[model samples]
Target: MRRRISMLAGVAALGLTLAACGGGGETPAEDSNAQDASGNVGVFTWWADGSEKAGLDALVKVFGTDYPDVTFDNLAVAGGAGSQAKSVLAAQLKAGNPPDSFQAHAGAELQDYIDADQLEDLSSFYTDNDLTAQFPADLVDRLTVDGKIYSVPSNIHRANVVWANVEVLKKAGIDPEKPAEDLEGWFADMDKIKATGTIPLAVAGSWTQVQLFENILLASLGAEGYNGLWDGSTDWKGAEVTDAIKAYEKALSYTNTDRDSLSDWAPATQLVQDGAAAYNVMGDWAEAKFAQDGDKPGVDYVYFPTPGTEGVFDFLADSFTLPKGAPNPAGAKAWLTTIGSAEGQAAFNKVKGSIPANTTAKTDDFSEYQKSAIADFGQDTIVSSLAHGAAVPVAWLNDLSTAVSKFGGDKDIDTLQSSLGDIGEKFAK
Candidate 1:
């Protein structure tokens, strides 16, 4: 999947953290003076908002109750997308005084930490706590490397969803319940939205917006063709891949923003919420914004899997890795274990509006559309992550972003297809 932005339209994006599941560990050296009867844990994350902070604080409250002696230093390092936090983490890890635990996404993101040998081995932690039986084998495997577990996934989020305003669809005389079934159907619906004077697709043409392009291509090409282009399994020059790129080019033309200077995702989010734009391609977490605005799913807003890949769920799971030389290694390992626990996942994601990574976590409070996502999680046909971020190297994905932005501006299918082919051919090596 692509990099996750805050799902709440007006709110800043929130990052994740790590904690252990079962119990106290011997306090590490950095926290030697900080330890008491309770395990002292230092956590670093990027969540900044009253509600988001409250939600996280609720997790802290739970942790405190379970481990009363545990002390916590909530470090708020603010910057968009953890740009500052990552830098601080690198320094701390190098200095051997890192936070007890920190955040990173699941999948390839964990590879770097594993290769650096900074993270504690959690194979024993997972087995002792029975986490292996709790989380899905695929998810466990994605977090595990070379027989060592370095991180614990916090939650699973579906990325390939189109959030549409129900009233806008109704105004366009389109059925809110049953969306267009295929790519042509998607265009027909968007055409109706445009005809109704609604921006067909709300978008910002920034690098991150390229994830939507990948989502659209995934729909057109299906998993095999899309993954092939990224993982060296398929030739990007093949007609099928070209056709997928062409489909994305056609969709790009329907975007609401001007090509010169695009709006940011927050404003694009507002455009859809305010009904100025009919739809926004975003992750399921964005539902939190709609809920905050007092909108009900299927009534005020409707979420549909991107057209043409209705049953194929594309997902991203959030995880936290212990940076090398973490200040509180034992506490960090404890945090990772906590993140993988069903209770902690459910508690954290409930406020965050994401599905718990542990399959056993109850999802009774999720909204109608979110419940649908929980159902999809049970099905084995889902792809773990989309190609834009975790599944492929960041360098290749950046190239794809450039190609997408070019397509968004030129609206030329041939040019876009050639660019994708060129990039794909190189990455396939």
Candidate 2:
């Protein structure tokens, strides 16, 4: 019960921005007429390739349909969770050339921008569009800071899904219908699959690897302990943290020998889809990749919460924020309107393989995988995603990513543990 309260407190903390921080430069005072707003609205994001692009295309189609005069500028820079793109975005924001609206994860990740005062309060925007009523109350709380909302979330994604190839599992004499109840059984199955002369697990570097670490932490430490890591309640140098790191090391062993060669997460998902690997633990967005290739769920593949996270929803969201000096405040507002609309949410999330942030968004036409995700999200113990910027701020995640990636290369559990402690000291203040 103590841990549960701590977890919720950490999540609630996302809604409170740094009070000490000041505002960004001069901004437009008037919001453009969303309906009558006619011009190019440059919405920048990190989804430039593969299935991610397809999801963006679906959203763009909706934007075009609703706002005919507003041209959607696809200013996407490809990187895992906007890794490479963020530095570029920072430069633009610093130079006062920020995009009209930009993609940001919907949790502590928004704190940096808010602290810099680069983001505009969307509270008015929400009231204007009835978005406050449309979005889940809990989600709205996370998106709000002080009394102001800074972004419009497009969709909620589960970060703890394991996508497996059905035929590959069958070939290894494993039942695709049954999900491994715990890591012991899951690793045993991976061992069996490894004996079949294939990569038992598929993974990529940087943020993807960090994501894998967080999932392992969730499995080894449970939701409370996992959430405790961010709040200093979980001892970074303790035996449990050590054990989770070792487990992460063991899991990395089953991954592809050429993981470094696999630059982006989709390629890792592709490995599973192509039957080169048996499983890929990734966000539900991987479902979008499989869907793009005409792969049917439960036939070509299957999804389950990452082993040991059966009833937990590892949550993250992709949202667009209106920058303070956005060249087109009207156009930014228009794009945000589409983002908050039930029709727009349905269109975007359907092709995106995620549940809409808007609770009232229709789901009758969604795929089986999406429906399952929606149901799980509705009933599960919700935890924030570290890799996707829900659990930690960007600086902390970036430093931790470095530690995790180096450990992936060196296999030094001690160094990794020490690095974690150093990071916790530096950031968990």
Candidate 3:
């Protein structure tokens, strides 16, 4: 992959420092040495339901314990992958009605906000709290652009995991533990699954499809080529992309017809866990869903890299940022300080089924899947996720998602590939 945002090497050096699951801590609002705060602090996020909501609640508990005086306003608009929340935030920011703090993925996704002066630099915030040393060095670098940091990351999520229902796979004559070597091999297994009258792949919404599309690109193009899609080294209209989407289209054939009814990704994940679906290709956040559904790993469920994506980590981080004209900057800082704290990360990421961004957080209570994810993240070849805003700005991703969504409806590969090419060209210019 390109060296521009090479983060795994740095993350690996510090990644294992993160520790166990969420155990509520503090005096009702204290995340270990968080400066006291008061008044209402509106923190915007997409984690309004399911295990994702649980993660936010865990963090909020820590915040409440540390800053008892502050009333935390949960300004969450439920949506898969912030599909709805981002647009709301954009509108609010433009109208000069910004939340005190908001969640954003920590890469090119922040570009538009920074360019438009919609965000406040958190560089001094980092220095004051000693957060620079707490997070992986390369991760810190990824957060910085023009020598300023605009957000404090909570956790790292891997986008290319395939969660499987062991029983469902077993019924389909598929080995839950042994992942297929590539897309073709995976599709062969999916065919068997389809014959079993099970959803071979449970996908929901455009975001999920875009996520699957990127994983297909990774499997087809490798890390360097996938990275090139974002960095402009690879042509989106090239033969490589055409061949890749063929696999993507093939993968889609095994999905459930009721995908449109499944608005959030959790229900789709639930299908796999409930044995109604054989597989669900989702980010590690699905781990939280598995746990939430009381599915045990290796027994009730299993996971691997999306076919052909083994040894590659499709990465995205969830971070909180201070808006330029936040209503309560001090309260927002308190929220951020708590978010960056080891205890807060421990609590939040534990329920979130993601590894903490803070390297120094405790790790003794993590689930088996989480432990495996931390290990994988430490050693895997990390690449930015196009669906989750690590690789492309939100606008560009929306363009890609629109094209992918349309493809899902129309099944027109030529139009899909051509539209994507135009999007790439437009973004590149």
- What TM-score would every model get versus the actual structure? 0.83, 0.93, 0.92
Please report how far candidate 1 places residue 156 from its true position, in Å. 0.8
Tens-digit per-residue lDDT, 79-162, candidate 2: 868877776677667666677788878788778777887777778888989887887777777676787888888998899999
Q: Which runs of model 3 end up more than 4 angstroms from their true locations? A: 1-36
State the displacement of the C-alpha of residue 271, model 3, in Å, after optimal TM-score superposition.
1.1
Query: Which 10 residues in a row give candidate 2 its minimum summed lDDT?
Result: 1-10
- Which RMSD values do the candidates have, in order? 5.9, 4.9, 6.7
What tens-digit string does per-residue lDDT give for candidate 3 at 88-163? 6677677767777788777777788788877777788899899989987778888878888888889988898888
Taken over the whole model, the C-alpha lDDT of each candidate is: 0.64, 0.82, 0.80
Model 2 / residue 93 / CA error / Å: 0.7
Model number with the top lDDT: 2
> What's model 3's TM-score?
0.92
lDDT computed for candidate 3: 0.80
